[model samples]
Target: MNSKLIKELPDLVRNNVISQEVATTIEAYYQSQQANSPNRLFTVFGVLGSLLVGLGIILILAHNWDNFSRTVKTGFAFLPLIIGQLVVAFSILKHKSKTWKEASGTFLFFTIGSSIALVSQIYNIPGDLSAYVLTWVLLSAPLIYLLKSNVLAILHLIFITFYAYEIGYGHYYSNETPWLYLVLLGIAIPHYIQLLKHRTNDNITSLFNWLYPLSVTIVLGTFVKDLSELGFLMYVLLFSVFYNLGKMPFFDTQKLRKNGYLIFGSLGIVVLMLIMSFDSFWYIEELVFFAQESYISILLFFVNGVILGLAYYKKWLQSFNVFQYVFILLSLLYLGGLNLPVLGTVIINILILALGITTIKIGADKVHFGILNYGLFIITALVVCRFFDTNMSFVIRGLLFVGVGLSFFLTNYIMLKKQSSKAKTL
Candidate 1:
């Protein structure tokens, strides 16, 4: 990763026909995108069709009541329900249609299923909303695989998205959101797998970008019935999204950006504010504070760590902004004594000093590590650790800072020479 070689990474990534994992992701993206153009067209028609049919049914119900008894009305209400289930079953069975036609029929069958469920409820049919929603999502699930329809997959995603939104945010914050997340994954995952196999579908990526957050948002919101947990979780999430973005090789900026990192990452920021507000957690309030086993947060931490390692493995220093900084905070809270009072403070000071040295050395290797964000991040962490943990003397802190600064300078001097020798080999 010399200066000249570092500059060529992105172009080489895009144009070199190596077609490795990079090609799978890239190919998946473009394939999904091509599928997306027609997907949009079919989607509009499907929604319009659902609405029109619903409207027409409503008009018939209003006027036809005079011509029908309760039994007749009930029979009619169940018509779409019965017909929809059969059509979906038929679509699954019909293995010879054009992909678009198979997808279109499945889409309509789902819409009709929803229409029946809605009508059934209005007519006082006995079923829970979750049950109905799950049924619809489940029934549509097979069509996604059966038809190889990205649109079918996305609709299933939206169905789960709205269901989760209802459970997590609506007046009823039921336990349904989790189940819905699983269901969405049920659909989005195959599309994800297809993107892996075919390596040319853009719609799959679009749907992935669209559904992941929708599901994650609902799930994260569930983590906090209170503001405190939600707040801490936010910063953790920011690390996840940023780390995810930063893990992309210098060449995958477009693909990474297309994945909606910022939108999800912004929410992570909002959550960070929430997490930071709980200054009490950083201190010793053993009895008053109840620590939950934040599986999600912990999972996020490990994920961020992997991202940092990938960036390092790829020599991606200039693009190092995501979850890497998360390590500083994580290092601070290392149940391994990094977060202990006197111990934690001293450890952070030392870690930052080491980080500054590492970044400068790495930067020397690349020559265009830009203004070294990783090094700047280390400095910022040192400042922030000191700001929040005021148990130390200012003089001691100042001396440590000055010491690390000198180390940074000398490290770079040695690193530059090492990198120069390395580059001579190239």
Candidate 2:
């Protein structure tokens, strides 16, 4: 419903372009459409306002903290929580709009944590920061589904990631593994699934697309207790999983920018390959296989194999990029490197070079500027790696750089000329 069109309806009627009755109907129809549209700004501001107000209340209470009696402090601690709960209850019982549910739910979420912290402080309760965060996360997890709030769901993910870091990395001497992080992540999956099924194109759904993989990427390192060398293998497998998941029908249709899994997976493999190409990386003193401490990495390897098997069964391999299947080659190279380090180094360097050329070919076939530039970047990066790692003369290294630069210019120019020719013919 264009406002300009609505305004011109009367003029159209007066000019005999339409009857008065028709003009009135058109105006009414547009007015109804405008009314039915969701107010995105209002929802955003409402959530922000609720968040700021909650923080403000805490700040205000903190300012006059020492002046208040113990009983007064106790009352103040629960006041915000009680108010937040009531608001959330009203929003739920009345079946309020999305804005109301989100605003109230966000306000209540912070209040629960603030109240918990205040009570612990006032009563001299004993607990570590990790325990406090776990409590806050658990209490607020239900709010995500109860109010159907995307904000709460995102917050839950952040808190869980924080909790994982606190337990796994923050406590150096503690033997606690962040295994609970996986369980907490699993609890949030149904909500994400619902979003995938019903709100596939939503902005929140896109946010989840980025966060889910990033969270796992960050947390996967926590599982490495010993045999740290195997960590690299674990990461490669994880990225492979992400890449294949992104190739599924639902994710494949999305724009490249929105497909975080594909982006992360491809970039991860390329970076790992580049690192492993160095001759120094293959010089291992001791090689351990199937160690008890390396179970997480082993399990991940099997999981990646299963995923690859499924991808093959589904015939996805035909459309996959070279990097998608490069993990297998790298795995074998790692095993062979245990005995023949120099050979492994040579093969990896050759593999990277071949990968760059293949990528360039794919880019030429697709006529995509981004893909073409990415392929060029891979070659450029490989050249840069050799510049430092090899004992080549300075003049030769400079010539290599110049050659890569020339290729970039010529490749892009040819691509643009081809595109122009097609445009003109069309």
Q: Can you give the TM-score per candidate against the true fold?
A: 0.56, 0.89
lDDT of each residue in 1-426, candidate 1, tens digit only: 124543454676778744457645665666676654444555567645655765676677768666787677667766656665565567566643344344455545555565656467557778765567767777667766656666566677677766666666665545333545664676568666666456533544655654666566555564444444333544565445553663465313435345555445533543342333233344432321243324555566677667766767888766444234644454345444412446544544554455455555545655634324455445555555555556677887787677667756765566667768779999
In model 1, state the lDDT of residue 72. 75
Cα lDDT, all candidates: 0.55, 0.86
As a TM-score, model 1 comes out at 0.56
Please state every model's RMSD to the true fold in angstroms: 10.1, 4.5
lDDT of 1 at 77: 67
Q: For residues 48-105, what per-residue lDDT tens digits would candidate 2 score against the true structure?
A: 9999999999999999999999999999999999999999999989988999999999
Candidate closest to the true structure, highest lDDT? 2
Q: What C-alpha lDDT, on a 0 to 100 scale, does residue 257 get in candidate 2? A: 77
Q: What lDDT does candidate 1 reach at residue 19?
A: 42
* Local lDDT at 246 for model 2: 82
Candidate 2: clashing residue pairs, number:
0
Weakest lDDT window of 10 consecutive positions for candidate 1: 284-293
